[model samples]
Target: MPRQKNAFAHKKNTNENNQNKNSYQKKPEVIQEQPEPFEDLIPRIERLEAKFDEFDSSILEVRKRMEQYAKEREEEKRQEELERVEAEKAEKAAEEAAEEARIAAEKAAEKEANKESQKENEGSKENQAPEKNSKDSNKNKNSNNSAKPFNNSNKNNKNKKRYK
Candidate 1:
């Protein structure tokens, strides 16, 4: 029985060896090197973080400049609106002044026409008074001359007979 058991075990061992040989051969594994530690990568991380911070600062500066430009644009718009309003008001005032001047000119022209008509009336009245005075003086002189009109000299009178 011991010789039979020894033969059976030897056969099992040979079969195991044969099965292992029939499998695909694996390539020898090279010794893999370990990755670098965090202590070695700290400087690179710090450099990348500093670059990120610089990018963030640059973006912030750009945002601030954009806001400043927008504010300046708004101020310019406000100034233009104010100037437009002032120009409109000035134009309205000028129109009103022109209207007032037109009214005043019309009044002045009326007054001048009235003064001219009054002067004409006064001149006609003055002329009539002088003519009336001259006619009255002529009438008085003619009446006085007619009242003493008996001075005559005649040579051939029958009532004055001469004996020479």
Candidate 2:
């Protein structure tokens, strides 16, 4: 029975090999495309090269415009920085001027106060000088009156002694 199975398998393999051989013999024909003529392709190649050149020129123009834009932006930034610095300087100057004005006002106020105090001192000194002079004159008059009474009493005593 094993020998019979082996023979059947051998027959199946041989049939498959025969079918593969027949398929190979009946292969489909391959059609080859002919290359285009050089004259016909030259214009097409030139058109492609022209388009490439146009693209390259457009790219260069864009790069130049971008560089110009960058320079413009840098210049604008520098202008803005200069303006900011000037504004700060102006503000600082204004602050300094204000401080100077405040100091000047303070000094003027102090001078006015000093002038007022000096005027008050001079007025008081003038008022006290008159009062002091009046008091001294009164004292001198009282002393002179007391000395005249003593002289009159001594003269009266000498007259009484002569009459006795």
lDDT values for all models: 0.86, 0.89
Candidate 1, residues 52-117: lDDT per residue as tens digits?
A: 999999999999999999999999999999999999999999999999999999999999999999
Best by lDDT: 2
User: Candidate 2: where is the Cα deviation over 4 Å?
Assistant: 1-39, 128-164
> Model 2: which residue pairs collide?
none
Residues 1-164, model 2: lDDT tens digits: 45554556657778779988899788697988867669788989999999999999999999999999999999999999999999999999999999999999999999999999999989988887555558778889888887554458778999999999
Score residue 101 of candidate 2 by CA lDDT: 100
**Model 1 score (lDDT):** 0.86
